[model samples]
Target: MTHPTLLHRARVLAQRFGIDITRHPSDRTGDHLVRLLDRFEIDTVLDAGAHTGGYGTLLRGSGFTGRIVSFEPLTAARAQLHRAAEEDPYWTVLPYALGDTSGTIELNVAGNAGASSSALPMLPRHRAAAPGSAYTGRQKAEVRRLDELWEEITAPGERVFLKLDVQGYEGHVLRGAGDYLDEVVGLQTETSFVPLYEGGPLFDEALGHAQRELGMSVMSMVPGFTDPDSGQMLQCDLVLFKQSDAREAALV
Candidate 1:
């Protein structure tokens, strides 16, 4: 279902600022997305919240030889991730989640896919309509700070690209990365202006965090089909770049 309110608002804003939102594709991870990744010359990818290894499969299919470290907390999903990596030595699957601090927590599983799961306790009004009610079962999974994982998985002098789609946990995940932000060249995060999930931040707030704390600049925002340009805000996929890396990339 398309969100007319969101589309209307986005279109109005685009008209006012002379921004071209028409060219932004609904599926951000298409050829255009791959082209953007190529521009950064990204070798290694940190696939935070990699659901069923679809993104990893896409990257490998596109000739990305660099290592992919995927993190998924759900038990069933992790099995699928393992299967996807069975033949690919470069892919390492981690059956865990990333947070500001490392410890075990309750992972609320929704019947749907990655978008439905959350680390938070309660479901938001918007997500209440999501297929399958929240599961009460709990799992003991290792939660690590991003900095620690980066040190463990990445080699020195390797430029890193992070793709964070951890439902509502993006802020906490970014916070955990701390000083390791310097090692990253590019990032793609799922943002929500409205509370699509239980604990997600608003679009402006998430963008501000990326700028002030993460030391990154917004490169682009791709709206989902439900989020049109004009009305009720939904979710967006945001691309970001470290200021220094962005400048260097521009010169290339």
Candidate 2:
């Protein structure tokens, strides 16, 4: 490992170049996520809305050895996702979308390599931020509730973490978790600040649903999806943690 003094100096020098580094990269979200996994002894991760297995790769890169079940709907993306998962025996990719019900839904495939694909309609705000992410086409995809596959993906008494990057369809995904929501030790979902996707819940609504309904507490928030022109943040990833008791206490 590198020396602590050199690391500190590097962080300070990087700041002089107008780069903001938190106490630990200014509280990086992924760091907190891995910390949760280690602290809670997480064994299985449900990678919801996993585009091309990028999230699964991140988890492995971050030292998570647990099982990863990724969900991807688009054909082209799933093709890449399958190729990526070929190396990791523990990482499994499923070609489907997680929603409130199990059925077929039209998924909007974005031009930007399905990076902005979603079951919900994208609004002007989202399109303006990344023109390349504009809707390219649509395809019918099978939707399944997380609870429906809980037994197949995980075992009882195993700590499970659910990460959602389903664009604006997070609400339905959470609902589909069913009773598994209470058992989820850690949760991460992309919450939009502005109207990125039409008819989707905003930041406060999503946060409220996690805390009030799902009995989870906000552990960290990582900024994402900023407008290039205005430089305003449009969305962020909310990382939450839940304890076995009330599931209502701050992590600190």
Taking the tens digit of each residue's C-alpha lDDT, what string does model 1 give over 1-252?
Answer: 976677666665543322325543434455555666667777789999998897788777665777899999888888899999989988999977999999887777654543456786534444333323344465566788998878788988877889998878888888889898777888888877666666678788888877886678776776642422344445678988777675456766
> Considering summed lDDT, which 10 consecutive residues are worst modelled in model 1?
125-134
Summed backbone clashes in each candidate are: 18, 2
- Write candidate 2's Cα lDDT for 174-233 as tens digits: 889898888888888899889988888899999988888777778678776766456677
lDDT of 2: 0.81
Off by over 4 Å in 2: 1-29, 243-252
TM accuracy, model 1: 0.79
Once model 1 is optimally superposed onto the true structure by TM-score, how far is the C-alpha of residue 175 displaced, in angstroms? 1.7
Clashes of 2: 2
Q: What overall lDDT goes with each candidate model?
A: 0.73, 0.81
Distance from true location, Cα of 118 in model 2, Å: 0.9
